[model samples]
Target: MNILNIDLYSILIAYIGIALILAKIMGSLFEKYRLPAVLGEILTGVFLGSSFISIFSPSLSWFYKDPEFHYPLEHIGHIGILLLLFISGLETDVRTLKKTGKVATISTVMGVITPFILGYIAGILMGYSNQTSMVLGALLTATSIGVTARTMMDLGVLSSDVGTASLSASVMDDFLGIIAIILAIGASSIISLAIVGVNMLLLIVLELMVGMLVIKYIMRAMEKIKTTKAILGMSFGLMLLFAAFSQMTVQAAIEGAFFAGIIIGTTAESKIINDDVKAIAYGFFIPMFFVYIGSLINLQVFTNMKAIILAVVIVIIAIVGKVIGRAVGAKMGGFNWKQSLQMGIGSIPRMEVALVSIMIAIKGGAVKGELADIFLAATMIFVTVTTLITPPLLKWSFKDEIQQNGG
Candidate 1:
């Protein structure tokens, strides 16, 4: 194929158009299926990703041979994911989280530890080196709420007692996921650091301390902002500034925004900020990001048995890890066994944040780029299955009826 055939700009335009249209279609379809809107978008992503369609689509195969087409799309997609993480932070009720954060933190610790170790072992046993093992562990440490949130929202369990705890666990998961990525990256860089092992302990303490201080000061100033517009607008502008501040590690920026959101989510101001940012972030960047991801699909990667198997195994590990961790903790927390099991199932889907981290890890050469594709596929599967199943389970548990619809 001639280099001229690979028009970067044209691909970007095409990828965006196709992705957005697909996103809406899939979104509505999933909604009809009683699943989260995210499942549709993600399933679309996997459909776009599979080599069977992408590689042999004859005239459509132009997208695969052209990195110019896929690479930029990936970058744009990542930015979408990053902003989504920031949005996650914005949506969190910081005051309630603070009240729950400690309890959640204790649970998150239990949640991550067993999984981290199991993931590390799984990676090693699966022929992944220490480096990939660490990366594997980092990826497993995440709990993607975007996928789950859509499901929970559609099912009307998003604000219920069971739903909220699952949400809180994921919120804590996001915060911890970012920290885990940073520590994993840190650990991966200095090979000698391995002698002492990954020291996420320090990151855990420091993030909470700094996060608390940042919140105390920022919220005080935020309280004085009379116009709701100014508060939400500047908050995002600032978020992007910090996100780009460390090009190599945007986790800090993402986490910072999340913490910032949690603070406002705790206040009366939450409704104002929530109503506002929805249009701003979702309207532009998020769509761009998801579409770009669609564009990144190379359909040929699926042929690699090693990559395929590793992806499947890691995904299973991710699910088992979270289920065991959350269920056990929930039982201890006095939740019924069924409720605990439901929470475990409810937490399976991955979101934009984890995807972005995979993008960065790929770019930095910290991990294999193909791993990004694997994670995307695995996450999509989890989202689709869990989203549909969760609603029915919740319905049965709650007597299959809503006396007063929250909606």
Candidate 2:
């Protein structure tokens, strides 16, 4: 292979190499500063993507501009998102969720409904169509359980009443967010809405029957295989199979991937493949997904007064809605004012699921053209800002607890 003889395959290999290296370094730096590594990975893309490279190093910008580079990278990013959702499903603690009690249930409901309504109203007031507003609402309905749980663990409260409720509620929040996106996709017409409803019902039935029954045995059978990594291979294959089936029926591949995870997660073999799956996902695919999200962001949007206004308004609505809604629910669920506030702050951050919802909405044509560009950029800002602010605010909310524990 001549070093100078470059082709599309070569370009892709080179791009992946550079992206992985940069993603790892930036991710490490972010983790060192106690920030989300995903945010840093996104920033890496921004630095090398059109936002910065086009301005700082015009020659290199061609890599992003060339379709040869963009499309393949995009497909890889899709795989990353699928794996991410699968991991989310795998980590879902069904037993804990059932035991989350009335408090978690009430908080989850209000947390989802409040942000969704506020986001929709904000979108409508800003002159967006009903479908776009619905998608916007859907975007606001998820909380980043990963970020919240990590913060809680660090604060020594992951086992506290408030922490348990928040984590369980956040898990439900993801499920609702996915549902919201599906509803948004079908909201364009009455016939579409009816079809969507039917599809949802079908999905539920299938998930109950196939996911619970068939997949269990399949995983158990795979466990008998003596081949190296065979269990892992079988698990990955099941994820893809379910993803395809889900997409074919419900028009959402991630939905299938998620359900597949929940099924396999219940199997005894789940423990065996969990670490390896995460290694493949985080080490390569998931970082690329977030970076691809970053690359899609048009930094030029920030310069537009209209875009700036929209982003700011949405961010405010996101923070306020979650706090108010979850707080009230927490209070109603038997917490004091201070504890309710803590719950609210804990539920504020929205990351993977939020970003995935908006991206899917855009790709599904629920949002398009200038609106898509604007919303995408606004969402990136929203994710970054929420992820940044939640940790410090969550700590502040837990001050009394920390002080009492002698920390």
Candidate 3:
């Protein structure tokens, strides 16, 4: 496997080079057609990986199947995932979140409750066991804030009123979704719920009190040491610290990254920090993350009749439950139909969180045999379908607003 006498490691370089070149090419094509560039990046994954290539081009199958080629690519993509959320947080307006906290909380609760109940009922109707039904319900409660955030960013609305509301509500969704998954797995007692509640309380206190104090201190320190490079180093280290703390002990790492961003965002060097971070994240990491997400799809699921049906049903319930539920909550909080629709459309995609719940169920013995396979297939499809639909819906919902604002 020597390429110009460079050994197999040169293969890694070639793989990354090809992926980046194809990603940018496809991303540009999608943008030209007035769609999110990420759609193209994901489609690039679908084309290059097993979904299409492994099946269609078995002769070239070694390219994707060789772990030597794929694993490192996947690892790079995972890092992209972290940076994407970190930047999202950096751009967040905490004050806007504070003003809409009650509404967002209400939206999160309704968002989780409806999908959970509907998914549970769907599972029961399909003759699945009680524990399986619980797992299904729990899986339904997840919201992939990253997916939604990417689409919103593509639309240039990532920090808009609806965007902030969606982000804040999704943070709550991820929290509740994780708790539901743990409960469904039957791994923890009621005490686990109490601990989660306390964690939530602590997160709020930390955000309002500790977060402010720390950011205030960081801002003052930055003013004294005024190099953009040093500020970036400190800010990035802080974001990673928060992300690690959240994942190891409390909330979702994405939420922690967002909070970390907020902290750095408050400082005068925010713009400089943002430009540098964007160069790194958007340039290399985030695109790989989207491609990695796309590559995970097993198109073989399309061959299973039961799995296809299950995917359709779960996806429908997922869409209706999140949209109608969140919309209802938004209306109650004083938003009109238009705004409610925008918020609902923005919050419907479920990715990593839902996958985690489904995986937990499989490992815990709640879903097994043919049922486990079907559930996994269905969940992957559900996430894909939901991810596909969000961008257009958001564009439709926000078209008037964007037009009125004059591009």
Candidate 4:
């Protein structure tokens, strides 16, 4: 191990706090610009990235720069992402979505498959081995449902047909993404009985079934409490418990949270949980996830023209490949050109999800730091670009509706 000179704990505290504050500023600034809050977070991260920060802090050391510092908050980010997913699932209108579910499902499936294939093709062309290319495809398949959910909510369209359809689509998108991960994780074909790889597929399905049963029974047992806080708090606590038990995969915890929220419904305290917890979540923890992602980019590698070009090329293909892939899919699913484009743009951000995959790949020894860095940088760039672009595109497409609603 390399001898560490800097105080990692202190540096983490300083960095996390400063990062949160800046994220808030960036979020607000984006909101002011009529952009998605997610856009602000990503741009804040990109703007305050380690590359830019290093110019002034040459004396500062890479402490959390190592993987260990990532663990604690990485876990927390998982929690945040879980909560984000659950809250989003809670807000989804299942009945309306079931009506258009066919379109949404088809669109979402195509979104993942096309991106994966395109990313894989890009990988092979870029000289990545088959395993590397497969992992890259898996990385591209990660969709940020959190971004679209929050955007829909802010636009007061969460209950709209478009919002409902998008939510349902993302549900399938996440599920398919999980399976893509399994395939990628097992690309080397060394499966353990510990259920680390293929077993994940089984467990994810089982977790959803168990979560539904548990939520159905437990919710009825509650008898509709006077306030949602107490009940939701209990449910949230339960979510944490199950999440701890399901360390087999972050996908387990994520799907666990979604089912927990879905069974809880959005009527009573789901809104309350979202309001109370989102402040801490979107405000602090989630930004730390993005910033940590940004910090992973080592500018020293940029001195290598090959690495820089590879990173940029991957980022470009990530965007173009997914957009083109999903656009046709959405169009086939009855979306107009604009909605199809929005769906494509909406599916683009891949921060926490890709990070989770990267961590898994690294641990499983399927990928290394350079490839991981390439994926991470590519993901961050994709996220930043899409988050900034999607909101306006959405707003423009829905402007007539927004105007009619007096919003």
Candidate 5:
């Protein structure tokens, strides 16, 4: 285990150890300043990542240079994201979502449509090809439920009316964003659209009917085992299985983890496993996921004038589109101005799905080499800016409520 000649396993072990320790330290520091711990976790990655190291300490860049190192870290981060979604699902109150369902649905529709149209038009105005413009629009349509859910939970508002609606709406946003991706990639045939629609319907049926019944009984049997470790292990395994199934069918594994959590939330075991699940998720996986996201951002993108301008335009349109669209929809659905604004802010952050859409566009040959690089750079900036801004804005938007409740 020579440090200089470290193998893959050794490198991975060292990386995880460093990541967890730094993440915990930064997360706590951010919390002390009343900022979201997620922001600190992400910043830790930025500081340790190639973006910083390549400029300040080129010798240290070798740690992330190997493809072997990159791929394993990415998969581990993916698991963190799935676990975050699973915990979000488990905490989701079905009754609250049901009460806010109409608002959520309406807001999600408007939220998706507005940003998509704006992004497409912005791309065209920026002189990108039609295909690239469609991809841009598709990117704007994403709402990162992981960021939203984590921030909401940190604020202790995850079960509130606005929180429930925002969470539900974010889920629908991701699904619709998938459809946008299909269109962007020139797969908008009737057959493709039908398949997506069917998948959505299937997810609904599975969550509400078949999946619920099956998981309920399984938990009941597991409960009979009478051991906390057994229950935790069973729950974690089911979450992974559900995530895999969901990825195979709907192309979104987090959705599967989410639906699984919702099902498990209804069981008596939910209470027993809640704290343990949080300990596992927050202690390791979730922070790593945020850090991985930060690492993906290459600050060098800002060096290109064209890319910087494009990112600025895209960021403005992305924020304005979501805020206006969701606010209008929320108002139409009977919310006050403040709550509508809160929903708008809640839906602003875009992460994994946006990046995926752009990659699909580039790899599918819709965007050419130089343009693809530009688009990717602009997208990374967009994701980073949107993510960094959301937590603070969302907390401020709910300020009056927090004060009223003495939170």
Candidate 6:
């Protein structure tokens, strides 16, 4: 076989095999240490990707050098993200979400505004151009719903008040962040913010209309499927279709997968579907997604002191800003200080949503040159730190409750 026509199938097979094995080993090890399994998966990626790959296995440099292998693995990892969110959507208690709706809204709004303002100020104070500052602000506004959701599930609090509020707030957090990203990018481009705002509103309306129509059709079709295998197949197909559609029309495919799960969750068979989704997702897809997130981290920019300082400042603002904002919002919503703080801590992780926006801003020249690399590295660091912190904070926050339950 010619070098130009390398065996894509073998590469993919090897990648999956390696990813799954590492994810399982690391995931189990983390669980053994009383840490979140996803953390281990992500660490595995960090150990293998841009950060530490060359140190351990220079021969494997071809993995990242070849776009053919890299891009497909990324796509597969993205599928994992979609499946995780879809499963989350399936398990989401809509009634609980509605009960916490007002608080979730308030928390999400504060979560977006405070971090954004703080990030913008920090950037400007650091002498970055206003355009770059605004993009930095936009990046700070993201809340990684999947990461937080996983933590809540791991802690067995996904259905609790703080957990539900966190999940609900994340939806709003992602929504507002998406809008901010559009505005920030628009400020740098020929397009006016007003035009971008209008386009965003239109996109939301269109997504809602199309999502509802497709979901309804899927629900009815699912009713006709009798066998377990057929139902599972139908469920997976619908999830993939909706996820792809969401990517095409919206900011993220997970958004569509989530809503698709919500639609299926309304059916009598939803519990069965949820279990099935969980089995496949946790076993493979979701772990791959987190590991892929780690793989994207490049610490090469850390050598720049200015970038490092800016990154540290931004991380501080990101962490403190979210805690203060969401804690206040949670307090206003009648949560006790413990629950409120839990909510704040839960809001801290920023992953795919922020990353996608940052990548776009970099490509669009909103954040230029070495600054972009530095910012990217910083975001990855804090996201990892936040992910590491949440589970332990959550356990601490629920100590009394857990003790009372005799755990």
Candidate that would win on TM-score: 2
Off by over 4 Å in 5: 1-8, 101-105, 124-135, 138-191, 226-228, 334-380, 383-407
| Model 4 CA lDDT for position 260 | 60
Tell me the number of clashing residue pairs for each predicted model: 3, 0, 1, 0, 0, 0
Q: Clashing pairs in model 2?
A: none
Query: What digit string (tens of lDDT, one per residue) describes model 1 on residues 164-279?
Result: 78767776677777766655655644463352233334433454566556655675687687775776776666556545543434334454455445544544545666756777
Model 4, CA-based lDDT: 0.65
Better of 1 and 5 by TM-score: 5
* lDDT digits (tens) for residues 1-407 of candidate 3: 75567445676687567777899999999768655577688767777666577666677666566788777876777567667767766776666555657768887788888888898889889887666877888898978876678777877888887788888887667657866775566523346546755775577468656767778777668667856588788887888788677756653455567667767777666777789999998989887777766666567767989888888999999999989888888888767888888888877888767765665466457777778768877887788789878888888888886786676
Error of 1 at 97 (Å): 0.7
TM-score of 6: 0.74
Candidate lDDT (C-alpha), each: 0.61, 0.85, 0.75, 0.65, 0.79, 0.74
Provide the TM-score for each candidate, comma-separated. Answer: 0.73, 0.93, 0.71, 0.72, 0.75, 0.74
Candidate 2, residues 133-186, lDDT tens digits: the string is: 888888988888767788889999889999988877877888888887877776
**Distance from true location, Cα of 171 in model 3, Å:** 9.0
Question: Residue 30's C-alpha lDDT in candidate 3?
Answer: 76
Candidate 5: Cα lDDT at 319: 98
Per residue, candidate 5 scores C-alpha lDDT tens digits across 148-244 of: 7778787888888889888778766766776677566653434654666577667758766977778778988898896658989999999999878
Cα shift from native, residue 241, model 3 (Å):
2.3
How would you encode candidate 4's per-residue C-alpha lDDT over 149-227 as one tens digit per residue? 7776777767875677677777667656755765676664324313455566566677667765666666556546666
lDDT of 6 at 403: 75
User: What's model 1's lDDT at 261?
Assistant: 52
lDDT of 6 by residue, 221-336 (tens): 77787776677778888777776775565344555676677677766666666777788888877777777777766667677787678777877888899988899988887888
